[model samples]
Target: MALNLTLKPFERIVVNGCMMRNGGRKTTLTIENRADIIRETDLLKPEAAATPVRAAYFLIQSALIYPDRRDALTKSAQQQLAKLATVFTPQLARHVFEAANNVSMGEYFTALRELRPLMKRELEVLGPAGLDPTSPDELPRIPT
Candidate 1:
């Protein structure tokens, strides 16, 4: 199967670990085979991974961008998912579990799709004053 992607001017995308930016005009990309592709808008920098869910997303993104480190990245993402599930409501936790399952099955992009909603929910629940970005230990913990 082939995938078609359209990029706006100056938009960037990473294909098989190679970063490419579209020229001044809109461009369409046709992925003819299986490849790791991620858009610039979806890219999350390590410094921006302040929330637990965002951190998990970063790990999954890394797995896709760096196949050589997929094992370690997947493991870390799974562990973080477990912790996040415990802290979130059961409904929201389903997203975390689904992402973990996808990661385990080598579907990094699918896993990222699952995590996106959870990331938004996390921000909605935490709000601005709720988190201390400088300290990760301050993240919400599971109730005993």
Candidate 2:
């Protein structure tokens, strides 16, 4: 199978940690083989990782962008997930566990997908509080 990407002018994507930008015109890219590709819009700025779940997502995102540090990033994300599972309700925690399991299996993308729903749930639970300063429970700093 292949992945097709249609990018607007200047749109960016990170493929296997190499950042590429579309030229002046719209472009279409067909990834004929498996590769780690993350669209620019999906990129999460480190400073904006305010919530626990968001932090975890950012860590996993880092793993995709920096595969060289995938071991360390995956470890940190798993630890964060473990702490999260303890605090969240059983239903919500299930997702955290699933994400952790995916990370452990080297499925960083799947782990991210699993955590997406929790981001929405966190917003509902935290409401405006989610915009506050980063939570102390947020995962440790990830190298740039």
Q: How displaced is residue 47 in candidate 1, in Å?
A: 1.3
State in Å the error of residue 108, model 1.
1.0
Q: Tens digits of per-residue lDDT for model 2 on 32-117? A: 99898889998878877888888899899999899998888888888888878987888888899999988888777888889989
lDDT of 1 at 15: 86
Which stretches of model 2 miss by more than 4 angstroms?
Answer: 135-139
For each candidate, the alpha-carbon lDDT, in order, equals 0.82, 0.86
| Per-prediction TM-score | 0.87, 0.88
Task: Write model 1 residue lDDT over 1-144, tens digit each, in one string.
Answer: 999999999999998878999999999888999988999999987656778888888888888888777777778788888888898888988998899899999888999999988878877988865434556564322221
Q: Which ten residues in a row have the lowest lDDT in candidate 2?
A: 131-140
Cand. 1 TM to true fold: 0.87
Name the top TM-score candidate.
Answer: 2
